[model samples]
Target: MREEVNMPLNLEEKKELVKEVSDVLLNADTILTADYRGLTANQLTEFRKIARTPGIYIKIVKNNMLKMALKDSEYAVISDKISGPQILATASDNPGEFAKLVKKFIDNNENIELKSLAYKGKELDLSEIKKLATLPTYEEAISMLMSIMQAPVQKLMATMTAVPTKMVRTLDAVKGTKN
Candidate 1:
């Protein structure tokens, strides 16, 4: 026969678990909360597949559990937004990328409802979050800036190369005039 069910953990153990989870959440780079009430199992699976790329982590948890873990934690900034069957996505790289993916998914699937988002413990408003979703990621922005910086230098080199031919033509004209 199966062994008897073990008794629940004492308060100290529970506190430790909460502290550990809170620390993990606090250290996270980005956190996105959403209502997954209407999403089907298949859709959630697809969502997970999409999230798995780029070191994104998705989890569904009880609001109370989240609240307990986040209380007095750095992640408490988003505590108010966690309630009623909420799901979270944590991104380790390019926080904006995951937000963009979520926004795209929401646009495609009307079932997902975005509730709130946080970047580095600062909660983002709806419009701000949308703007973040639309923005190019940190790496992409850096690359764009590098390309822009290189453009002017490339143009200057092209203009400088023309100077030699112009000087030659001017010298030839002077010699012809002297003759």
Candidate 2:
């Protein structure tokens, strides 16, 4: 087996990386950082495949570079969780859905541990992230709202039809008894 040489990223490459991370951060609705130290390449690839939703981006960048990218941004609070072998995952829409995806991956992978998550510039602990994961997606929420809104109308219509049908039944019974 050939030993792989670890090459340091040059100044231009580092700058470009920081820029790319910054751009992602600017549009992100939620940012999740995890300690991916014990995860193998295959496990990481599996996670990437599971996280293939649109507007989601995941990367393992140098801590310093990530810090530089996060500097002066709303996500600056996440720099505290940037130490060690951290994998950053961000999504532009539906933070709860992103949290659910990360939670599912963590549940399946014993080696990976959740570090912290930042949403709307606020830092949240693992428990809070779990709560976030339980939240419904946008489509689910809309469907739920529609059902709730229709319930009263449906009940009213049923009640109105029931009164007329009951009167018709009573009239038929009275006419039969008279005959």
Candidate 3:
């Protein structure tokens, strides 16, 4: 006969898990809490794809555990935003990029919602996060500026091409005067 098995984690194991999570929280630049309550399994997987491309990672945590972990760190910005069944998506370098990605996904998949964003220790509302997503990335905006600035130089070159004919006309007028 098969016997029932009951296994409980020792104190050391629980402490270790909390420590690992705390380290992750401390190193992250931004932490966004979102509700995945209505997303299907496939939708959640799609969301993961977009998040991971830009070095963003997601974790599902118990509200109380996350609250305890974020109590003393920059994550305190959104510590109160945490709700039951929240998924924490975090980025190590640039939170804007991550927010943009998440916002894009939410835009296309309306069912997927953005609960709150904690950017560089500042809490942001959903509308604010959406604005961040609509703004072009820093590099893209710079390239657009470079193109706009080059237009005047191009026009100046076209105007200078007629210089030779104008100079010849002036020389002809001078010869007539001498005659």
TM-score, candidate 1, is 0.77
Residue runs of model 1 more than 4 Å from their true location after superposition: 1-23, 167-179
Candidate 2: C-alpha RMSD to true structure equals 3.1
lDDT of each: 0.78, 0.87, 0.75
Top-TM-score candidate index: 2
TM-score between candidate 3 and the true structure: 0.70
Q: Which segments of candidate 2 are over 4 A away from where they belong? A: 1-7
User: Residue by residue across 29-49, what tens digits does model 3's lDDT show?
Assistant: 767888888888998888778
lDDT string for model 1 (1-179, tens) is 12556666566766665665676686678777889998999999888887667667777756777788767766687888887898777777776787788887888889988888778878878667677787788889999999999999999999998999899999999999999
TM-score of each: 0.77, 0.91, 0.70
Off by over 4 Å in 3: 1-17, 94-96, 148-179
* Backbone collision tally, model 1: 0
State the lDDT of candidate 2 residue by residue for 1-179, as single tens digits: 12555877779889999999999999988988888988999999988875589878999888899999999679898787778988889989998788888888888999998877888878877778789888899999999999999999999999999999999999999999999
